[model samples]
Target: MAKKELKKVFNLNSYEWWRNHRRVVTFGLFLSIFAFYLGNPFHKEGKVKDTCAKLNSSFQITGDEAMKKLNLKEIKNYNNRELANYYCERYLGIK
Candidate 1:
């Protein structure tokens, strides 16, 4: 392709570039938050340890337990009562 043609084909200004890269930006945000939670000293230590331990064990749990282990309750998007209950009923098991 010619330079002008390529430039026309892929016009990338700040707004356009950011719009096209929104998913990457959102993923980066999620990663940053997850990393922060992983290292947060005031909390997450015991919860993470317990969750890891539960995962390592050959056990099943109800959805509530799954949510607890995954820290889903703390997730803003999926933290509503209905969703939490749904996760408990549909995705969790006990063993």
Candidate 2:
């Protein structure tokens, strides 16, 4: 059989189907990888709190003070770790 005929036999719509399902496919892959990493005990939550505490002591500034210094607004959807890390890495001149 010709190559075109062989490809038709193997469902040539596979590429088109993948193109249409990109978002679902990407989310599924991210979830699977996230689940694998979330299984680790060393990766427990509240770790950022401890890190933040260390950051506070090391920089001589509490989280609240750091937030105020950085001018992070009081939003319900805030990322303290990101803000604190930014201060640590950027403002405090810590490596």
Q: Specify the highest-lDDT model's number.
A: 2
C-alpha lDDT score of every prediction, in listed order: 0.60, 0.65
**Candidate 1 ranges with C-alpha deviation above 4 Å:** 1-13, 42-95
lDDT for model 1, on a 0 to 1 scale?
A: 0.60
Per-residue alpha-carbon lDDT of model 2 for 1-95, expressed as tens digits?
A: 68789789988658888899999999999999998788764553344445555756656556566566555665466666456677556543567
Best by TM-score: 2
lDDT of 1 by residue, 1-95 (tens): 58777777777335878889999999999999998887786465556455545544565444456556666754556634445455444444522
* Residue pairs whose backbone atoms clash in candidate 1: 60-93, 60-94, 60-95, 61-93, 61-94, 62-92, 62-93, 63-88, 63-92, 64-88
Candidate 2 wrong stretches, greater than 4 Å = 42-95
